[model samples]
Target: MSSVLLFNKPFNVLCQFTDDLGRETLADFIKNPGFYAAGRLDRDSEGLLVLTNDGQLQHQISDPKHKLPKTYWVQVEGQIDSTAIDKLCKGVVLKDGLTKPAQAQATSEPDWLWPRNPPIRERQSIPTSWLKLTITEGRNRQVRRMTAAVGFPTLRLIRTQVGPFKLDGLALGQSQLIKQTNLLK
Candidate 1:
């Protein structure tokens, strides 16, 4: 059986097990050896990060070709409108080329959300809104870049789900071992 760990990564934590720069890493939260992160979340983003001992399962989860959609809850600096949502859903043109159409919707900030350390900057003059976005491709800073392309800069980003696994019930820096059967789902 493969050892699958579902971790709720906190903001500023590096996705790797170790960092030569002495930053907080998976090692700080997970003591279990031989497990590796299936995908990466940027240091500024927070939430569900999958770690697995099975290399095949890791590839299936991380590879974009598999099209395992990852969902994120994002807080943007502006009051996002339907047009922006439409653009995101219709595929926005980015410097790296046009992104594939994604599931994007304006949402209210989740009441159950944990407070981020070094909280996102707030401006007195501008309003902020939340969005729930799901994308199959995991490009570097894709969510942030996508929102920016539509004129709403992301203030906070949290990945709520990846494939069948979710960050629900996991606290910051907390982790739980998932059954292989659940992972297969």
Candidate 2:
């Protein structure tokens, strides 16, 4: 049997279990030796990261062909409205060509959220808004680009969910392992 771990990675941490630059690594939190990250979370982005001790299972979870929906809780520079939501759900055109259709809905901040270190610049005049977006594909900086294309630059990005897994109860830099079959539910 394989082990699947769900971790809520914090901002500014490398996704790898080891860091050659002497920075924080998964070893700082997760002690499981054989487990490896199934996919990547850019150092700039924080949230749910799935890990597994089985190589084949790692491939299945990280591969885009699996079409696992990756959900994000993004805070943008300006207010978000129906028009922006529509464009995001409809797909935004990026230099990589048009993105795949995704689900987007206005949402509120999670309860007991902590402020980011060296927090995002606040434009005293403009307010930020939260939006829930689920995309099956992961492109480099895709979420940031999509929101920017709609006139709202992304300020803070957090991956709140992945497939059947949620970030709930997993604090920053903490992880919990679940049975592989749970992914199907």
Q: Pick the candidate with the highest lDDT.
A: 1
Model 1 TM: 0.97
Candidate 2 residues 18-128, lDDT tens each?
777898877888887789998899888888999988888788888989988999999998789999999998999999999998899988876757678768878999999
TM-score of each: 0.97, 0.93
For all predictions, the C-alpha RMSD in Å is 1.0, 1.6
TM-score of model 2 vs. true structure: 0.93
Q: Which residue ranges in model 1 land beyond 4 Å of their true spot?
A: none
Model 2 worst lDDT run, 10 consecutive residues: 176-185
Candidate 1 residue-wise lDDT, 77-125, digit = tens: 9899999999999998989999999999998999889999998999999
